[model samples]
Target: MLIQLAIIGLLFAVFPLALVLISKEQNKFRKLIAVTLFLTFDLIIFGAFTRLTDSGLGCPDWPGCYGEANPFQAHSEIKAAETLLPTGPVTVAKAWIEMIHRYLAMSVGVLIILQMGIAWWKRKSMRHSPWLPTILFVLVGIQGAFGKWTVTMKLQPIIVTIHLMLALTILGMLVWAWQREATQLVLKLPPLLPRLLPFAFVILVLQIALGGWVSTNYAALACHDYPLCNGEVVPQLDFEHAYTLWRELGRTGSGDFLPFSALITIHWVHRSFAWVVFALLASVAWLSRQQAETKQLGNAIFAVLLMQFMTGVATIYFSWPLAIAVLHNAGAALLVLILSVLNYRVRSSAVPVS
Candidate 1:
């Protein structure tokens, strides 16, 4: 089963690898990184979809479905489970979803390995240290471990949330590495930007973490109204139970069923902290727009921010529709990518070119 799974992962990576090999660009390394980054972005979105669809336990195992390489091979077991519990997490569709996610994750790992190999092979000619890809390689392994824990640990809220965060971390690192290789242009920006960009990045990461916590805990619909949670300025909250990070998915630290107030607390904190994230990132975007070199990225940041806010509200108003919720997750990732690039540009601007 493991060997078969390896083959499947290699097969999945063939298309992107071919694209990199056949690209017109002179910097195939950069092209490869870009492709890897693109797939990582897709992986994050699909991970969100898998979670949203309750497909995390679709396989009930790590790295394979029912100890088989693909869902097709495990169909009988999946069907049996579904028969036993019609609406449970195991089903044909969900097993496929979970397996596909795992396959894509493996393909990404392959790409990162290729990246590290090439980086080392051409270390002398490359401008940056090969350690960048090496670091990414290590991080991807850690992310994979978290992915396994997510399943083995029964989608423990903290584990799942950390898995989500690690995916974004890998995405951010890829963005930073790609930017370094893609361009060397420097921007002339206000002094405040260098200081503000990192602060904004921190704020955005915190918000993303909160967002992940909400999603993993299935708190999206806890407050079914927009701008006002359950029709109150501040609904009754249970911070004590809401943030017991080591507990099971829907239970308090003490093993009690988590109260509605706890879910409300989780939902409320995510939504409320969002404003600070928006204000800070919006400021960064507005400042970025002032510079010609970064104007497009600035505009993109603004657009995604607005889209994120709308999708976030829509998820509530529409009662947590899957598409909108997934979009919210994707938007958060897009923000991470854009901010990474912006930070790279800003920091490069400060450095005196030798």
Candidate 2:
């Protein structure tokens, strides 16, 4: 099964590998990094889809479906499970979804391994250090461990949330590494902009964490109203249970069924903190737009911010439709990607150009 899975991963990576090899660009290594980053972005999006559809346990195992390399081989087992619980998490369709997500993740791991190999081989001539890819390799390994725990632990809320956050962290790191390979831009901006960009990045990370908490806990509809949760300025909440972090999916620390008030707490905190994220990020975007070098990226940040806000509200108003919720997750990843680029540029500007 492991060999078959390895072969499948190689097959999935072939197209991107071939693209890098055949590209006319002088730096094939850099091209590979960009392609890996693009696929990582897709992986994060598809990961969201898998989670939103409740397919995380479709295979009921790690790295394969029912000890097989792909869902087709596990059809009988999946069918049996589905027959037993027709609306359960182990349906044939969900098995496929979950396995495909695993396949994509493995392919990304394969690509990163290739990146590390190439970086080491070309270390002398390469402009960027190889250590970043090495670190990314280690991070992907840890992420894969979390992926296993996500299933083995029965979609434990905290474990799942950390998995989501780790994926985004890898994405952000790739963005930073990729940007470092690009032509350096030195912008003479107001002193505050450089300081603000990193601060904004930190704020965004916290908001994403809170957002992950909301999703993993299935609290999207806890309020069922916009701007005002449950039709009140401040709904009754149980933060003690909501933020416990070490419990099961829908149970409190004491193993009782989690209360509606706890879900309300999770949803409300995420929704409320979003305004702070928006204000800070939007201000950074507005300030960035004033600079000639960063204007386009600033515009993109502003646009995604609006899209994120709309989709976030729509998810509540529309009762968390799968597509919109997945898009909301994608938007968050996109924001991370964009902010990574902006932060890299802003920080790079500080280096005294020789």
Candidate 3:
């Protein structure tokens, strides 16, 4: 019952608005993609918030809560469960959060379907490549599968991390498609740094993967302090438990409760590699400053990096407040977008033949 309503609500919320955008916009295709990409990024950030808040299992059911599409519809069930367990995962608030996440996910999927429909209709147009949207359609489909797998598999760390990587991949692809439409083939790169942009993307991808791992593994509080963890020089390590595969989402290989040390391991790795990522982004921004089209993108990346850093510190000092955590997620997604745009601008914007 709740699933049906959520699906209907999502279609109404997303498809109709996109149709309106298609009809009213001068560049309907670009506007549609822009809006979809914006929403996708927002969804990813909210997913992070959902996970951070332990709302991943709030509904404790996939696509619905207690077989209801939305929380409101499942109020009775949620209340019953709350009464029975008292401290269980099926509270009304949690069910609402989880269902809202699902609703947003479905809405984004609807937008992608619209994007693909429009792309197919305009397939014959000489200037646009329909393949980009087509590829995004396929990617979104896979992302949906991962979304289900993430829930059904009990939020397996690997599955959740892969889901995150998929989201970033979708963001990059959309930016690429948008760039292809926005820019003509006349873009030329500065001769000094032809290879830098792609390299920067590679670095960003690695860092983003680590960030996903950190988030999925619940390592955010592994080390509550900055610059050092646990007031120790190196911090007692537990890579075996930290990197154990095929274990429960938050458990260790030996079936013992995951220790703070293991969390510290995950957190430290993310923090340590961040230095390298920061240097790489700094270089990319510096290099882009030398180019005409990417100058603004580079500056934006630099600014977002600073904001991300501040938010990271705030999450620590402020005891992982929800706003800071959500903002950190947003900042991370924006960094991905800025880097993605910079990548698209540098890659697709034609370069002089050597």
If scored against the real structure, what TM-score would every candidate get?
Answer: 0.98, 0.98, 0.91
Q: Write one digit per residue (lDDT tens) for candidate 1, span 67-182.
A: 89998888899999999999879999999998999999999999999999999999999899999899999999999999999999999999999999999999999998898897
Local error of candidate 2 at residue 344 (angstroms): 0.6
Which ten contiguous residues of candidate 2 have the minimum total lDDT? Answer: 345-354
Which is better, 1 or 3, measured by TM-score? 1
**lDDT tens per residue, model 3, 72-112:** 77788889998998766667777777777878877777777
Question: How many backbone overlaps does candidate 3 show?
Answer: 3
Q: Which stretches of candidate 3 lie over 4 Å from their true place?
A: 1-25, 86-88, 185-192, 350-354
Q: Which pairs of residues have clashing backbones in candidate 2?
A: none
Q: RMSD per prediction, one decimal?
A: 1.7, 1.7, 2.4
For candidate 1, the lDDT comes to: 0.92
lDDT of all predictions: 0.92, 0.92, 0.78
List model 2 lDDT by residue over 1-354, tens digit each: 999999999999999999999999987777888999999999999999999999999999988888989988889999999999999799988998898999999999999999899889989988878999999999999999999999999999999999999999999999888888888877867677787888899999999999999999999999999899989989998999999999999999999999999999999999999999999999989988877888998999999999999999999999999999999999999999999998888887653222
Q: Which residue pairs collide in model 3, if any?
A: 2-68, 2-69, 3-69
